[model samples]
Target: MASEPQYRALFLGAGPQMQCGVGQFTRLLGEWIEKAEPGSCTTLTLTRSEGSFTEIWGAVGSARSVVCNFPIVAWKRVMFTPLLAMAMARLRRRKTVLIQHEWAGLHWLRRITYIPALLLANTIVMFSPLVRRELAEDSLVGWTAKKCVLAPLPPNIEAPAGMAASDLRRRLVAARQDGRLVIGHFGSIYPAKQPNALLEIGAILKQRGLRPLIVYVGSFIRGTDNVEEEFHARATELGIADDVIVSGFVASDHEVFGLFGAVDGFCYPLDEGLTARRSSVLACVQAGRPLIVTGPALPDEFDHHARFKELIDRGAIVLVPRGSSADAYADGIVAALKRPPVQAAFDFDGWWQDVANAVRAQL
Candidate 1:
């Protein structure tokens, strides 16, 4: 109730409407806060308009907490900054935390506007080492490190029960019977995601007489220069267009999980520049799907990578070196496909409990 102030927290960054890493980070934080301290905390999310802030607001009202999910472009010469600063000042007397999820300083002016709000917060949470490293590189972390804490993004949904290894192998065999080796990727299509690499891998597979079906699931954000179309065109140019299937944005979790379950292997060939920890890899791990992730080296704290490597040492996920060519990555996939699938004993509930403890300690 407003009569007794709750531990107010403001999640500031673009959100799921933007369908980017930051958006996913904010959404997960909101979930963790609610689940951890139910009825004891209030959340306010500031994101872009495309983000369904209002929809999330309707879901969580002003009773136990208020969801102030609003869109304000910081670079604009609007009065939003003054309004936000005023709001932050008013909420300062309450137990408040401001969480910034963005790693890139896209608009220098926008960073200038948002920096003060972050500095004034009781605590600042960085979702990954990449985020912290970015801040440090920009001298932002020096200003906020005492208040900064590293908390990687959690999976948006709980891991689902996966099909047994026997069932998955049988399905893969059936898919192969169609003369296609199922290779897939999920999440929003962006240049940073490197969809072209998938096309390259498809070409390589075809060269080896292995028909490759590259499936992409997720929609593109509006006005990002239509990178998805470019990817499709490039796939065609690569001579593997017929093998590519771009199924844009499956809405249901079951559909997404099913897609992952049916695939032979998943690819995440992210370019090195865009470095924020990803939850997609976590989803793959939870689904018990084999993976081929490409980016700068992942932090040791990533549970899936650690577990996958452990399993590899124990003869589980087939681990290959980074920068391995499409052929090498394909080899890893083939090896993984042939091996027996062994699901890791992930403690999802325990993971949430750890998150709860972190929030409690902060409070």
Candidate 2:
């Protein structure tokens, strides 16, 4: 047999060397494709320029198609490595796909660098109308608009098998038994994520004569502004520092979901409101606990994510207005905990299949 191309596609990714969610997404997607089609895709994890070119180009050369998810937030050294490989693939006449995970939220200078990748990709996939709208606002990538198509962002984390929610719940039972509410916030802690909202809400909960324990299942992003320092400083100011817990980076999905299981309910008052791009929220909803999230700025936010929409329709998730006061958020938090626990029927596997099929169609 001729060894023309061992894999159906070459998936370029920035590995989990930093605080990037795309890294997790890239790995999960590669695993799913392999399961779905047997010998379908090869995932090449890139870290900066060290041995990236030869390996990425070799993978690109071996496969029938190329797919890359761009904008590895926080790690700029290897940011454009995938695009360079895509250019090489195009030179060899291979069709290239770009998964645009972010844009509007990035700095203007960073958005400028996306121009080359936008032009190099044969097909550009966006996860939401909001992202498409953001991309369209910039005339730099205007020509690639026709090549753009919308896709769904499935949860980055799946509930680990055999991880009993009952066992996990026992860990937090002592605090709850003492009349304390555990309010969980998932994903990288940063100002954009409004982690301070957790502290604020916890303070408000205290003000209303209730005990609140704020738990961050993820860690703070150490960036240019000393994010971790500020988070603790603000917590100190609010006088809830002792009540807060930061789990740092938990590597195990079982542990992550276990923490999810331990919480009374989850809350995220995102600065940008709810949208299709918050993979953490997607993961948290699968815990089957009540979730209080801010309403999306756009009405058609969930158009591409029908599964999420269905969950919202079924009352498994609650959405308060974007600028609701801390008192209001506190009220929603208390109310969400009181709501009967209804396991969400969020067809996670089905969502992944839809996303995979949509993307493979372009390939």
Candidate 3:
């Protein structure tokens, strides 16, 4: 009789373009698996194209053992996902795992593609309680109640503690010494992110006798789209174009941290459309920087000063309601910037380890 195939673990959504929380979580999970099981387990990454595929393959090759699973596609069309799933099913034995992210949809016809994999998977990892609720509501897990596990998202990169609080304070003071209050925003540039709202807030700050220097770091997510162009135009219209510095995509975490260090405060003015926890907020917490967030109100748990609740409280972070006018957001930013800095300790490493252990438990 033929011997049964060796049990190998597959990470379904590992790609180079995957830069969000889900990607970070999957990569760290793979690393932990290597450390825990050594050569006994393997990670299978699905890629979209061949170009630069070798680079990613090499990066992951350092793993104790991993495999690259690429599906050729005529375009970015997702029709290939079903075929890929079918192929994966054939290659899979023992048990496989499937990790779901925000975009995992559940249309009846569309569900046909990944439904088989979901049913066959020994474990399914979900990133948030919201995701778990969605899955439970859909009843997509079938009778495999034991297979689902809630795993919190992971940070993209480990945060570095390079600047002391005194040094950071000095940098902020220096930036403000020239009569301009340096307010920084970092993250992807997109309409849903509400970059234009920052420009409007700058105008409001100017009206309040505060000269605002706005700095945006990070490249536009979808290219030179109309939304970004309009955002720039709004700044120009406000006559604060010179005060606004659009630093397109700083690669170094230190450089990003320096920007945070230099700024009086950080602003995140996302619209109500976004639902995921803000990674930028996590970065701010790790960097020990205060924030001026304008959008849907954060949960009450974020209101406490030491705990996660305090991070989102109106006391710690200035919260503006979603759809609030640019002027209202600007007023909130000015008020937040004027408040004295509050020192708080955050355990980023501990957070990652806890999340990793949760994923390990399910595996």
> Each model's C-alpha lDDT?
0.57, 0.79, 0.56
Score every model by TM-score.
0.72, 0.88, 0.69
Off by over 4 Å in 1: 1-4, 8-28, 44-91, 94-96, 105-122, 139-146, 159-175, 273-276, 295-320
Question: Candidate 3: which stretches are off by over 4 Å?
Answer: 1-8, 12-25, 33-41, 45-87, 90-96, 104-149, 163-174, 223-225, 273-276, 295-307, 313-316
True lDDT of residue 116, candidate 3: 56
CA lDDT, candidate 2, residue 206: 81
Clashes of each: 1, 0, 7
Clash pairs for candidate 1 = 17-51
Supply candidate 3's per-residue lDDT for 24.
55
176, model 3: CA deviation in Å?
A: 2.5
Candidates in descending TM-score order: 2, 1, 3
**lDDT score for residue 95 of model 1:** 34
In the range 157-211, model 2's lDDT, one tens digit per residue, is 7887745443334646667888888888888876678788778889888877788
Reference-based lDDT, residue 336, model 2: 77
Best by TM-score: 2
Query: lDDT (0-100) at residue 13 of candidate 1?
Result: 43
**Residues 109-172, model 1: lDDT tens digits:** 5567566555555566555666565666676545675666755344555655553334434555
